[model samples]
Target: MIWTIKKAIYRAMHGSLKVMMVLFNLPEPELFTGAGSSLKIPEVVKSKGINNVLVVTDKVLMELNLLEGLFNSLKENNVEYKVFDDVSENPTIQNVEDGLKLYLEGKCAGIIAFGGGSPMDCAKAIGARAVNPKRSVLVMKGLFKVRRKIPPLFTIPTTAGTGSETTIAAVIKDPDTHEKFAIVDMKLIPIVAALDPELMVGLPPHITSSTGMDALTHAVEAYIGVCGNKLTNENAEKATKLIFENLEEVYKDGLNLEKRNNMALASYYAGVAFTRAGVGYVHAIAHNMGGLYGVPHGLANAVILPYILEFSRKDAEEKLAGLAIAGGIGTPIESNEELSYRFIEKVKAMNKNMGIPSSIKEIQIKDIPLIAERAVKEGNPDYPVPKIMNQKECEGIIRKLLP
Candidate 1:
């Protein structure tokens, strides 16, 4: 009964948000893609008339020297910047607070998000807070809450996943609840995004596979969701094809810049597709897994994706079948149902080939109800999931993901 009421409230909220989105008609960011596009970040910063900048990133990226190219560009351009490398795998509100503090203390004029989803998300949250200092990050949790324009924000993604570079949403977890929440507003969108495959070449095989699957989930969910339109479908189709073709090659030979570039483009395309159309139950549950069990976001999404596809098959058959053909898993002559199953099998095979485990070993049975409740709360109405799952149904799905 509580879940029913929560769903009704979320549905109502989403209905109003759809109306608001149409009313506002937000614009997407300028994107630069290729092997050396990240070198353009300093130029973009100068063009925006920004002097001092806040660089939000993680220690791993720094240790790997993945940020050297961007740092060199900034130095060559004589741009002053402060680095805050404390962002966690699942960024917390505290991370945002700490970054924002640094941004203010340094009197930064702009933000350069310099890593994966966590840093990008933390940077956006910091940008939002810089503009709206009166409101808490907690108050800015839902759609269209950010009314003011944030400072100029630029992104240089070291991973070919999350698509946070192009998306207008940011996910941050609360320290008290250990639950993840999102800030969805056009103001959170970066002014510029650099999808430079050169930065991604050093990713380990496991990271490559997991992040590739994450991109796949974004594309597949966007294609299957009810909010998808013709433009989004086109992007999703292309993203699916690129990921299917390039992910394995890049996973096998991490230094292959050509395959790496293709995977980066696939991630960008998936990001664009899902930013407008939105993702589905896979992300909805995966976010909870990350928050609750410390599961890596990409790995969680990769493991949860096939099961959700199976659950959504009845409603998303034609779309999934189309994706199967786009992904080269099925011929045009195959029936939609057969094609859909073939697509599911292909995903499973890809996971096996990439060394992504089928189940999450850390998921506790006792936590399913809470995870299910949070998943439903996060996905209902807004996500346009083929089937709306109640707590019990969501628990059933999570049970299958357990070791």
Candidate 2:
């Protein structure tokens, strides 16, 4: 009876929220996609009328020379900037505070988020803090909690994943609690996004595989999730097809600029899809794994994705079958269930080919209940997952992934 009441309350809340979002008609960022799109950063900066900017990045991207074009563009345009390169793989509240300090100390007029999701998330948090200086970042943890407009922000994604460039959500961790939370608001979206495949050409194969799978997960979940609309469904289908076609090629030959560009577009499309439809249990569980075990976000999602799909298969059978057709994994004659199984098999095969492990060896059996509880709390009433698992069912999925 308690579960039934909770579910009813959630359904009512979710429906109301959806209605409000539809009424709001929020706007997304302007996107530039191509081989050398990062070179347009200075132009965007100039257009936004920002002279001093904060560049949020990580050490590895700087060391890899991925920011050469961006920095050179800023230099040529005579734009002064400060760099905060201490963002971690799973950025923490402390990281956001540190970046905010840099932003304030440097008196930045805008922000340039450079690198993957970590830097972008940190940049968004910093921007949010800059706008609401008196408010705690913790207070901005839930949907539409950010009430004010953030500073003009531009995103240059160095990897072909995470889609943080186009999304209005930022996931930040709390060190004290060892938990991850999201700051979701249209105000947190970037003013511009540059998807330059040139920066992704030198990415390590393992990173490429994992990040590509992250994009795939986004597309799949968006399609299967209940909130999907016509536009989001179309974007998700195209993104899934692009990932299926180009991900392995990009993984094998990272320097193939065409395939790299395709993957980048795929990630952006998937980002757009999920930004509206929202992601499901895969991300909720993966976020917990990152907070507790320090698992890389993309790898954790990749490892747990197939299991979630299997668990949700009954609820999402028709959608899964459609994805199987879209992904070129099934024929028109196949039944929905058969096609869904084939699609799941295709995902497993892709993971195997990309060398993703079947299970995470670090997950302890004792942590299953805690993770499951957290996952349910995180996903329920927010994500439009086709199947909403209880704590016991969530634990079963976790056990399957445990070594």
Number of the top candidate by TM-score? 2
Tens digit of per-residue lDDT, candidate 2, span 1-403: 9989887877776677656656766577888889888899898898778899999999999898778888889999989999999999999999999999999999999999999999999999999999998878899998888979889999999888898888889999999988999999999989899888999999999999999999999999989988788878888999999999999888899999999999999999999988888899999999999999889899999999999999999999999999989887887799999999988988899999999998998899889999999999999989888887789999999999987
* Clashing pairs counted in every model: 0, 0
Candidate 2 residue pairs that clash: none
Q: Model 1 misses residue 258 by how many Å?
A: 0.8
Please give, for residues 176-225, the per-residue lDDT of candidate 1 as tens digits.
88788899988888889988888888899999999889999999998987
TM-score of each: 0.95, 0.98
Clashing pairs in 1: none
Tell me the alpha-carbon RMSD of every candidate.
2.1, 1.2
* Candidate 2 residue-wise lDDT at 394: 95
